[model samples]
Target chain A: MTTTLSLEQEVARLIVEALHLETAPEDIDPEAPLFGDGLGLDSIDALEIALAVSKRYGFQLRSDDERNHRIFASLRALAAHIETHRTA
Target chain B: MPAEPAFPLTARAPGEVLFRRGAEPVTTARFLAEAAGLAARLPAEGPVLNVCADRYLALLGFAAALMRGQVTLLSADRTPQRLAEIAARHGARCALSDTPASLPLPVIAPAAEAGPEAPNPAIPAARIAAIGFTSGSTGEPQPHAKPWGALVAGARAAAARFAVAPGTSIVGTIPAQHMYGFETTLMLPLHGGGAGHAGPVFYPSDIEAALAAVPAPRLLVTTPLQMRALLGTGIALPPLIGVISATAPLDAALAAEAEAAWGAPVREIYGATEAGSIASRHTTREEGWEPYPGVAFTIGEEGASVTVPGLPAPVPLADRLEWCGQGRFRLAGRLTDMVKLAGKRASIAGLTRILTAIEGVEDGVFLAPPDLDRNPRARLAAAVVAPGMDAKAVLAALRERVEPAFLPRPVVMLDALPRDAVGKISRAAIAALAWKR
Candidate 1:
């Protein structure tokens, strides 16, 4: 039987590929923080992820949106948002 | 008595656009009225630290302080420690910012109140206007004070050099606190009778959006780091007359590519926090610098120093240069940036240039091993962010460009270099990276 990757795994792979993370995709904890002390990612990284997600899922991540802090809280959170709103 | 010019420096026709906030255009009359209202409300006692992230708010705070005769303190670092230091220096507990809670000081938000606009205060040319904090690339951030007259003169010179005309609008990707952004984005518009986009754009798409929002002919003021990111995105920007870059070394290849992509020539401004804007060069056309009109440079065995009309003393620059007379010069390298290895010499700046110029290298920096004082013969090290490229391959590429002795001993691959908000890779950060290896 073929196995499909979970949303968390898929998003982790995307993050690693997009940001050129030294850590392996499976090594990234799903609930770990993605900003500040977590991954040491910055505003520029966030924008890159937003652009990549928009291209892959056909949904724009607006900077001024109130839920930005919540959506970008963790990889799991971001993946869940994409799962709900992704058009493509 | 000498005749005093207009206090605010900029007074355009009421309908003339002064700035664009998002998609909305603000007229000169409205901006002046708002600035006058805010100036009336500013505290007259202490130096005001302007930390507003919003470009429009920052500009308003700056103008308000100038009109109030309070010196504006420009710091690129928004850390609480820096804010506390600035507040303690001014002997005040409060600061002026749009986001009050972000700073350590007791925040006094500038005026948004409805009232009669006050007349522009008569500000003297020699009055100390603002203090700029250095980028801390070498050591601790040092304070450089600038008077109103010096700032205005520098702005006029930059406007002429960049060929910024009355209808030109600027969209800057740099921090407002830095000298380059302060000159090109804020002072140029106020003194040169041009409009500026009030958006602090970072992302490529956002920069494209910001550029499209402003009317041409537009000028994109950016740093090398931001320009690289913008170029990578392959987004189409609006029609531009020219692009001005500063705050870091812009590679010639990148300059040519940018010029080709945007259909506008790329000009680089060369100056420091102490001297403000002094010279310009078309990066693709020349390796030498053309000093601003009325500006002269004195190069000696010590280093290069510049003298401008408004400054009281000649400010020594950190770079070594070979003066090619007739108001032009070629930069040899940074004065203190030379590294000696195996009885051979190379500049850290030159090594960094070769590293970043390598194809597929996104961002990179070189550092003399942190224990250099203990062991003067310590080899160079680097932190690079080139995906799909191994350390050995990167070293191989470096070997082709520089002497083998100057090559990095261990090239640590990272996702990104730790650059500050103004795109300056601090020496401390570099030392930490090298020590990690």
Candidate 2:
């Protein structure tokens, strides 16, 4: 048996834990908008997720990075970025 | 009294440090020279929408606007809709932005240069320096214009209140766009002749690093939400001369916690966008606020009104208060039913208007319960009577028009709304509504 899980699931869990969202990790749609209507995350949530990602992984997430909107577009996008950038 | 000095409000001794840009100390001369260069390049007409992310660039943009006789429009709500609204309403001819977006108005970058040295331009006391928009109870962004004299007076009062002497540097977490941020972080440094850190540091580590990088006698200007977040990080902070909290009310406990942790007295400012910084209190020591020097309060049946120096007339405050003698007063509840979430003001009535305005929504109401635990900002719960609308659908519709700060969480759809004979939805009835989400 192989234990293979998607990075989206891992990032979803991280977001839920970091922001203390009411929804469970599995319930969060990977492609659903995380901010302003879908998951209802605000700017504060974005900062918290950024901090958590930097602490959990070994790379700093710059807020002024132009690709921030694209990177944090969805759980799948954020997870993909984390998979490629995470040093730890 | 002696005549006022003709130098620019931000003028300091040549070598005095006024800001730190990534560990490099930026002197007053440097700031003035760069601002003059930028001002020389800017149009001498039209309002400027400053969208500079770096606090220093924002300051330079603001100074250049003042020098060029342009009214600076400061709004933190940078949504395209909000920016478009500002451009339309304020006749904003250009935006000073760091981003490369194509705005309705041309975007001008505040580029640095070694242009011809010119003495800092003199701003008339009557000249309107900047216009700040506050989300009033109407949920519409209302303009509050600050004259150069009023800002200079307010900055002097604040400097005296916070004990920010010349060469004192402040590193703030609040955005430069907000009223308190405008006064303390920018105005205090410029008008009151103190130093400032230009970075918009938000995270705890970033804040700590910014503080560490700056010199001593530093002031940390922030809001309750940001302060709570900073304390939550539990990181050891550098020595701070004082901590200034404004916008939301700073509770005594949080104030004490900050004082104990940071070893600096927490000074809470009581002000609104209408009147910049009116009064301040050392929250750990007392509950009442001492009006800034030359500021007086007249308590009436309606509420408390303030008369500040250099203002034409007294402005009535929305908060109810009683005098404690010697120009000091304690805050009672709000005179009107308005909710202040993270410094932005929105009336419950105004929120209800947006809620019921939804095409599918029939009857709707919103209520704000006092958050004793300091819950996520201010949690506003709503009850709706739309037959087919679910909580998610209602919220989705609301997200399209409403600012994210005012959007109600846990919007419950009920079969019928509890209304009194006069058609008033009582708080008790709203609380009794069952949660649908």
Candidate 3:
């Protein structure tokens, strides 16, 4: 059977592709945040990549989402949120 | 006036080439040679259209045409249709184009090749150089004619503010056809103290490369969106004496981010479609901009209004502002950029920022339809990327931060927004998006 990737692996792939980030997916740590100190993604990039995720993954993130902190916490968390939802 | 500033005096003599992307740096004699070439080629009486891809060349063409006593029509949008329209409007018989691959429009190339040559060319000031088009934020782009003397005066005022010196390399990433870019990169090099890169730079990486290619004490003239994108890239940039950002609002947060990321203060210029440029802000420390020296102004004007040279027509600014001493004022958001909700009011710009701040929201924008004027409530629509989240959830969050009335109703989720050439969301586009209900 074809192997299914973990949430972390999937999210890492998404980040690399969405941002054109010059890094290998495996290089991304599951514990690191996607913005600020971790990946240093700015607000604009956040919006751009978020849109990408919505179109490709069929999931939307709302502004002022109380869970924003956790949702953006790390690759693991984002992957988890996506795995739990993702329509497209 | 003051003995016309002599050209080809490279403080960094024999060092760098005059133009980079697609222009030639020639001695004063060379600039005139190219001008003379065009003059010889043209039928002395008709207006000339300048489609020089290289911004520097366009400036030179403008000057050369003026000296040869020809009227120059400058159009920023060089699409075939627009070019044809401009050519017809001005009865231009020929055009100067840097792009060899461009259409056959009797295009002429500059005689000077791109490079560094030791030659001082004396150019007479006071010639009527060229015409420039406004950004068309308010409506259709209007043309503003400038005399050589006027351009020189404007550049002198700008140079004094920037404090650039001879041989100080200034690189531009913005299209030179625009007034702000023309003044900073082309005119500044000719009449003021610095040397400018030969071409227009458009990309973030190009901006970085331009900064490195130009020697120390360099200046970068760019728009706010480009500035934001450059910062987002998180690339290392060379030491910039200053970064000139215009063509849009330089929000305090964005400016602070730029300063923090680049370790250089981003100086903002207040300019528009009508006026070339009149005031500038060195730091966010002072709320408003200090006017370019020798320019004066007051607040209110209805129509047929006149203000200082290099300033927009004397229309009451769309936004309120706090004035500093003469020629300086802090811009509050535009008055028209605001909207009212049920017993509450907020700036659309503010809502856009809040929406953009959402996690996993790529390229989200809040927009209100023009028909909302019939019932100007806080009714809003938005194109968003938060795929998993529904419109109700989006509204719920907006309510938490902003007033409930200001919460967007009937949020329209779309794949993307229609941003224009400069990444600006036009009112028409917004209204069009709001077409359905």
| Reference-based TM-score of each model | 0.74, 0.90, 0.59
Clashes of each: 0, 0, 23
lDDT tens digits, residues A1-88, model 3?
1112565677788777765554579977778876544654543344455655666676555433122456778877777777777786
Each model's interface RMSD (Å)? 11.7, 3.5, 17.6
Model 3 lDDT, residue B78, Cα: 49
Q: Cα miss at A88, model 3 (Å)?
A: 23
Q: What digit string (tens of lDDT, one per residue) describes model 1 on residues B1-437?
A: 96875345564566788788887887767777788888777766658888776677788888877767788888765556656766676655357766535665568787544346555455677788888875333223467888888888888888778777888888997767767788888888887757887775766766788888888788888866566666765678899888888766678888999999999999988887789888889999988899998788999998989998678899998778897766689877657776644323456777788899899899998888645422323567888999999875787687555544556765788887887889887667767766663
Better of 1 and 3 by lDDT: 1
lDDT of model 3 at residue A39? 57
Q: Give the runs in model 3 whose Cα sits over 4 Å from its true position.
A: A1-88, B1-29, B100-105, B111-127, B135-141, B301-306, B309-327, B333-437
Predicted structure with the largest lDDT when compared to the true one: 2
True-vs-predicted CA distance for residue B212, candidate 1, Å: 1.4
Best by TM-score: 2
1 against 2, candidate with superior lDDT: 2
